[model samples]
Target: MTGKSQIADRIAARGASRSAAAAAVDAVLGEITSALAAGERVTLTGFGTFEAAGRAARTARNPRTGEALEVSATTVARFHPGATLRARVAGGSGEPLGAVPDLGSLQGLTASEPTPVETPVPAATSSVKAKSPGGATGKAAAAAKAKAKAKKADVKKRADAAKKADAKKRADAKKAQKKADAKKSSSKSKGKGKKK
Candidate 1:
């Protein structure tokens, strides 16, 4: 339910001018949009990642008209929330919602009032550890740890595959260049040795 204006207001209440807060919000959104448009992923450690995802073309039907149509393949913006944001939404922080002070009161308060302290959200990695304590003895904890380990391993595997592919590409380019150079040298030698 929170919109950009609400976010801007929150930042403005935190001693920043309304214009500055608005500008900051706009700059962040602009950068995220630009990155997504450029097919790059933007990851905000404890917030989320924004990326462009490909959707394959497919046939679809209209429910009301029973008409068939073709959908074109395209890239769409996608967001995957990081653990801290997900945990906060799931009420895993153990802190009551009421504990978060009302920002409305701060609007009218004088400068003499203490500035609200913003509690830092735990990092996504720390959040996972918080969910699965070291001394815990349960199948759920063990499963969670195994799943996390598997996910980490999968990421590493993908990175290694990409690195290998890049190296292969470089090697192929070098091989092509060497072949072309040898061909040019042979052609020159043949012309030099010809009587005509």
Candidate 2:
């Protein structure tokens, strides 16, 4: 995965020391994380915008058990890729993107408020409901919860197995020690009798 280390390596290759490059990456990420935690947004020019959005409480179905459950409202971080970034990923040649938003305009925009765009919808899917762009839906939260529970159970099972293996190892080591001691004592006793 192209993580912080990989980015730092690239930066270091460009002339900055490795430590300095790593520090720069850490500082950037740290600032973004803290800003999001404080209910703010961090916009990287020509990269993307990161912000926290509120998710409304709703009823969701559990994917594993197929049971209906109520999920509480929570805020989740969301990212909207900038036009430049999107273009870099998706090859150009389509309609050119609009003018990039100025930093002043971006700063004035709140995390919860996204710029509105009007799109013409065909009649085929007009009656169907579409997911809200504000934040994650109930189904997404439920799926995340299910995955987390599975991971926790797997970790616990592995930990219990590890404990049992350690206990057995210790017991076997003790038995071997006792057998060695008994053999040494018997050999010493026979040696003393022979000398007498």
> What are the lDDT figures for the candidates, one per model?
0.68, 0.67
* Candidate 2 CA-lDDT value: 0.67
Q: Write the per-residue lDDT of candidate 2 for residues 1-196, one digit (tens) a residue.
A: 2345545555554555556655666656767878888999889889899999999999999999999999999999999999888977798543324333432322332323322322234553343332332123334545668999999999999999999999999999999999999999999999999999
Cα deviation of 19, candidate 2, in Å: 0.8
Candidate 1 lDDT (Cα, whole model)? 0.68
Q: Write the residue-wise lDDT of candidate 1 on 83-149 in tens digits.
A: 9889898976633233224445434434333322322334532233212212233344677789999
Pick out the ten consecutive residues of candidate 2 with the lowest summed lDDT.
127-136
Question: Model 1 misses residue 94 by how many Å?
Answer: 12
How many residue pairs clash in each candidate at the backbone level? Answer: 0, 0
